[model samples]
Target chain A: MAKTVHPDQRYLLALLNNDAQLINEIYKKCAGKVKSFVCFNNGDANDAEDIFQEALVDVYNQAKYKGLELTCPFEPFLLLVCKRKWLNELKKRAVLPVTKEEDSLLHIGEDTFEQAEQLEKQQEQSKLFLKAFEKLGERCQEIIRWSLKGEAQEKVAEALGVTYGYLRKKKSECMASLMKLVQLNK
Target chain B: MAEDKITWTARFVEGDLSEAEMAEFEAQLQTDAELQQHLENYRQLQQNLRQQLAPDAVREALQQTLGKLNSQYFGHETQVLSLKPIIKWASGIAAVLAIGLFIWAPWRGNLYQQYHVPGQMLVAERGAASETELDKAASFYNDGKYAEAKSILEKLYSKDSQNAQLSYYYAQTLLATGRVEQGRELLTTVYNGESAFKYDAAYAIAMSYLKTGQKTECKSWLQKIAKGTTHYQKATDLIQKL
Candidate 1:
């Protein structure tokens, strides 16, 4: 089903385009809630700040890479992502009995919850892919990186001192190798 | 899997196969679960790689901007805000004396000066020649060397006439250097664009009016900044004072 693109997709666009004023609006309107949640939990203002920034970065990455579409208001969506992130942080720190906050009980929609889960999954897959990528030979890594940078294959080939045919053949082989490595790791 | 088969599968996932070969491959893939798995993995790799490896100047720019905002929101400014009521509760005699001193205070300077928070020019190309020149321009502009900043910005703006961010900073340099008409005109263009700078440009126009002591015009521009924008509070405050 084609989900209606929420008006708050503007916030996602702002993240992608690095629109400072709109981004500032995100902080101004949303940061207080995030700070309150973090402080009420086993966290501080600095912890909240870090979690907020990281969540925004995750949103940006999803928008840039996966074409993340927001179907809910950005505030609740952002708060949801921040809550999940803060919970994870608590788990990592082994903090016990997190205090309940009213803000954390935000009435988010099912679609928004699914969207946050998808973003988290995509981010985790990206980390695994990166881990596998680092295991590739330097030549394989270089070829794959250049090929995937949205440059023309011919231009990339020329820049890399290879013919178009050779670059294509090498790129295919490198990708094949990467897939095998990824499958093995999985 | 055979070496040739793996390469062929990878190439197919990459869309490197010709129309005839792709048609042939797709027909075979319906019954071939192993081929389907290989194809899925290759496709996933490409998507992940593209996402992971793409050059992200916007992300870098966003990080820098967030750092600055964090300081303002969570820094000493919060403490300063907490102290405001204390100032209001001072005795009437002390308040009168404070107002008398404030009338002569440099801190209570120009309205425009008090509120004109300049947007930092965060051009994302970190090490390019244009980026270096822009950094220099930003430095000069921040240091109040508007004339020097204006020269470099003018050259850049001419080359990239459609770059809204460049146009924004260029407009700021113009306004700073007393090129009021030219500055406001450029800012109008930014305000009309579909970027995040639209409200910022509006706020800049208001500041320019305040600079010229045009209170009515200033308030009108400030009114254009709707609620929920970063500038809305400042705009409303300015409007009330005006």
Candidate 2:
């Protein structure tokens, strides 16, 4: 499928590129909605602030790791994430009362909800990825991170004083080892 | 079958397969579900790789900016939490403060002495860039003139954010001046990035974590140092203690 860039691609690009003005605009534009959602629930202003920041960080993560193309508008998607996260927080804190925004997100169809779910799922997988990467010997972690970064395999090999073929074989072995670690973690 | 799968999977992912070879691979892919699953995993892995594993600076920057905006917009309640209570208990606070300082000042001094290491200054010798502000900052930094070094280093860092020498030395000055958090932030940037001082910054960052009582993160940073770096031995020793 052809990737469609949203009109508010600027919000995401601002986040990915760390554009200060645009980031401020995101808080100006979207944060109020999140704050309202959190505050209207049992969350205080501090809780609202924390939830909003956590949600934005997840959005940043998705954009950084997955090239997150906003399928729906940004606010709904962001609010969905905030609501889901706040619900999780409440659950973790053993709050038995359902949040007031429980059915507020019912209009966000299966796809948008699925995307939010995917973000949460990706968060778990990313933790696993980092854990597995760290579990490797330092050489493998360095080689895999640098190699995956589109660094020329030959140049990396030369830097390490190994042949290109050896680099490729070693990289593959390291990646396979990482995959095994992730699988075992799963 | 296994050998063919390995070679062909690698070749296909590499886009090194010829037209006929591609045709054969696709034909096999149609019949072989496991091959299909394997390729999907490869695709996910490749996607994971190309997306650049967590630079973190961007996200942190955004969060900092957004936090400021939050204070501006929804910060009415926060301001009301002022020092009124302290004013009410001013005399009591002064007595407590005097007692606290008597006991606390030496402990704070000891902590700084334990963790702070002044960075070695760059001398204008043998092919080094001579008589520059960077050199002045380095000299001041090494001489433990962190106040002068920090002022000069901040000027240099602001003027040329890309200069690794300025950033690295400035980060050290920041650390020396008891600004551990800001110093660690820059050290993190230096170590994660391509810099001559990456290994040094790695060691400094681990030390920062140690000083801050974050032993797990300290161990992780120490573990990332390759064996050839100057800090590798010290890092391992520190890791053992942690």
Candidate 3:
């Protein structure tokens, strides 16, 4: 069954549209809780701010790419995402013992957790892909970046000063190299 | 042959193949698991690349907007004022005026005494039964009988520890009675809660540190009170004296 999109998905659209007012509303309603939660969890305001910002960026990427639809309210969902990100950071830092947060018991539904986890996984893949892209030769990077820019292959080829047939062949080769690098990185 | 297969998979994923070639590729893909995996990886790569590399003015704009909002929302907690230049300038002027005027104009008395101005507890509108007891606690707090105030507030806090206002005043009473660690713990909890008492708790924590003559820690906490908060000016004033 298709889940009904929650009304709060407007926040995601706001991110896509750069709607400053709605984004401000998001900060006003949600940032405090995230800051509070991070501060309570052996993190400070700076850590909370970084985690919150990164979570918003991840959500933007997910909505931009995967056409993410919210099946849950945005606030709790955003909080859960930020909370998980901070916990991951805490684990990485290893400066403090990661205690089981009381709010981890918050019942936001399994779908929300699934959504947050999916975004995290996609973000991890993006990181891997980006690192691999960086390791590719400059020509390959240029071809791949241009070809993926939603332009016609012919126009991309023209922009890159290459023939259409060459652009297609070389883009595939570059992508294949990229895929191999990503596999190696993983 | 291997490179040809990879190229065909990418072309199939990107819709670059003609109908006849696509048909042939799909037919081969059904039986060839390696080709199927190659197709899947290319498809995933295409999606990821489009998402990652596509020119997104909105994404840039959103990032800029989020940077502004992050400052507005979480900026105050770590925004320490750079006092070195100002202090250097002040000392320069003090040397030029060298006629018995001190740079520390605000250092008239004990730093804690000058800055530890706790707000009155006025949580009476919560309920009738609690109102009388809270008002009594408020009276004791106002009269400087923090022990009496703590006795009542402690009892109330035990029932509703999540209440920011209660935790704040209880923390104040604990600080007043010299239970600095216990008081700071409560204040930290209040500071960590999403209540209006957050900066107030920070100010109280600063005052607690100041009372114990911990100037560095006090100034550190004081600097956490960003501009525009009720305690910002007072915290800065004390920071200057310190």
Candidate 4:
């Protein structure tokens, strides 16, 4: 008997299966708790959002690659992940000198220790990508910007007053160009 | 002829050509070396344009736009509903609806759910033999054991006629194992309402068609998924690439 799975397992399974709406519902159910934790740790709504996204990605990756079995409720698991992510973000910001206001905003409780190391590792990849992104061209920058925002070529073309044909060409060209730039810079 | 070819290549790369003109351009490119070179040059020009733009301004503008859109769409109260959460909710609803339909409205609901599951569970007191086998096949498929997986799935499908999961996975397995035609057939069956994995099955079928270089067939199936609710984002993503 494949033992009757827990609710969190079912929720995680739903996420792994790429059922977007169900995942949203679970996120809605737990977002407040996660947000509170983030805010208490001297984070803002933007930080909460970033942490939530990273936590979800982490959970999704764990489920897909490592076959992670959920031993706790979805809320606590997600909250734990997001809490650690926010704390690390604060610590990274700390390495640079900060004003009195900024200094006061950097706080992390001792309980956030367990996942802090993991969050640090995850942040490294994102930081590297951001650094690489800076090396790309203006057009490459715009193309990637619109692309990430789920902008259609037609929309991008209309907004920029270019033809759809030019937009597609530009997008592929920009990606290739960025790849080359990243390579050259490296 | 070369002048005419270059003009067509530019138009095609610029996305100014109609479908018919694009087709003609591709056909001509197959036999015309000059046209191919011109097309490559056009591609390089586009790349150069990208290399000259400013990254920070573009990123800042994009981020601002995304932030505005996110707030507008979700509102502050519902901002908690992130992409991950939305996916989770959709899956849960889909599964509950599937199971509910299976019980309350057996004929219609089961039929609908069946289109998605690929392999229907056996009702034996000891649980279905095919369920365990299909699970094994899934594990194998995930592990990149296409051949071993396909063999098990195929055997189970032979024993169980209407198992959608089996048929769907088998089709995917076939594609992975290099049996494109057979995989296509099974995928078509699932896509055409012969099996349960309707949305995902259709998406897979379209992807398989793409793998076989049948862009037209791939587009058609992709269009179907794009129109449907469940697989819309995936379909949209693929169509954009095409």
- For this target, which candidate reaches the highest DockQ against the unseen true structure? 3
Q: Pick the candidate with the highest lDDT.
A: 3
| CA RMSD of all predictions | 18.5, 14.4, 19.4, 22.5
Report the lDDT tens digits of candidate 3 across residue range B81-132: 4665466547644553442223323555666666676655554333233345
Q: What value does DockQ give for candidate 3?
A: 0.28
Query: Which window of 10 residues has the lowest lDDT sum in candidate 1 chain A?
Result: A96-105
Cα deviation at B43, candidate 2, in Å, is 1.8
For each candidate in turn, the TM-score is 0.56, 0.55, 0.57, 0.28
Cα lDDT for residue A69, candidate 2? 78
Models sorted by lDDT, best on top = 3, 1, 2, 4
Candidate 2: lDDT over CA atoms? 0.70
What would the per-residue lDDT of candidate 2 be over residues B1-242, giving only the tens digit for each residue?
Answer: 33445445655665556688778889999989978987787677666654435244666567667667767766644433346544544654465445434543434544323433444555333232347566677667756799899998886675345556678878888877776756776787788777778988887887777777788888898899999876676567557756
lDDT of 4 at A122: 39
Complex DockQ per candidate: 0.23, 0.19, 0.28, 0.03
For model 3, how does the per-residue alpha-carbon lDDT over A29-73 read when each residue is reduced to its tens digit?
Answer: 889999988888898886788788789988998998878899988
> Taking the tens digit of each residue's C-alpha lDDT, what string does model 2 give over A56-160?
777886887787877666767777887888888888778854566445544675557777888888877776677677678757776776665456778888877
TM-score winner between candidates 2 and 3: 3
Which is superior by DockQ, 1 or 4?
1
lDDT of 1 by residue, B1-242 (tens): 22455677987876667788888788878998877877777777777887777656677688777777776665422333344444433443365445434543546757766677664444343322344677788778757788999999987775444568888889999888876766886888789777878898999999889888999889889999879987787788778777
How would the docking of model 2 be graded? incorrect
Candidate 2 ranges beyond 4 A from true positions: A1-10, A13-23, A39-46, A64-67, A95-101, A104-111, B1-27, B50-70, B74-242
Cα misplacement distance, residue B67 of candidate 4 (Å): 54
